[model samples]
Target: MAARIEIEGDRCIGAAQCVLSADKLFDQDEDGFVVVLNGEPDGEDLEDARTAAMICPSQSITVVED
Candidate 1:
């Protein structure tokens, strides 16, 4: 199954771990909060997405199974 990304904006603390782990699927807004770049990415991207969620400092990154 592919993974889908979800971010809780209020919980984000401008940490870039998500962006650094999976830049193709995550980015930061002007306020430095997380922004979902690709909601659903398959294959290796899915793995990276999970990594992003794991490394997130604020625990705002959620990788949903699809």
Candidate 2:
């Protein structure tokens, strides 16, 4: 099963850190909030995505295995 990342919109503080950490899997909206570019990141990009979730200041990111 592939691992997936989920964002809690309410918990997000509009921090773009996730996007900065993993551009391939994350992007910021015009408001500077992060949104998942791809829920299923593969290869090295997946590692970056996981790191981004772990380092998120607001703890808004959730990683799940399916």
Candidate 3:
């Protein structure tokens, strides 16, 4: 399935769970805010995005199906 990855920077607490859970799809800026490395992840990468969304303490990560 295809999905879109979204990150809410204002809601992020810089916990880095997204980065830890899905490094290929997500990263952190210099200030440690969540960054989307690949907003449109597919295959196993889609799973990574889902994991990141699940583990985000601040609920900053979102995976919307397209």
* Best by the lDDT measure: 3
Candidate-wise lDDT, in order: 0.88, 0.84, 0.90
Clashing pairs in 2: none
Error of 3 at 40 (Å): 0.2
Number of the top candidate by TM-score? 3
| Candidate 2 lDDT over residue span 1-66, tens digit each | 588888898888977889888888888888788788899877787789789989999998887866
lDDT of 3 at 43: 92
Error in Å for residue 48 of model 2: 0.7
The TM-score that candidate 3 achieves is 0.95
What digit string (tens of lDDT, one per residue) describes model 3 on residues 1-66?
779998778999999988888889888899989889899999999998898899899998889997
Cα displacement (angstroms), candidate 3, residue 24, comes to 0.6
What clash pairs does model 3 have? none
Model 1 misses residue 42 by how many Å?
Answer: 0.8
The candidate with the higher TM-score, 1 or 3, is 3
lDDT of 3: 0.90
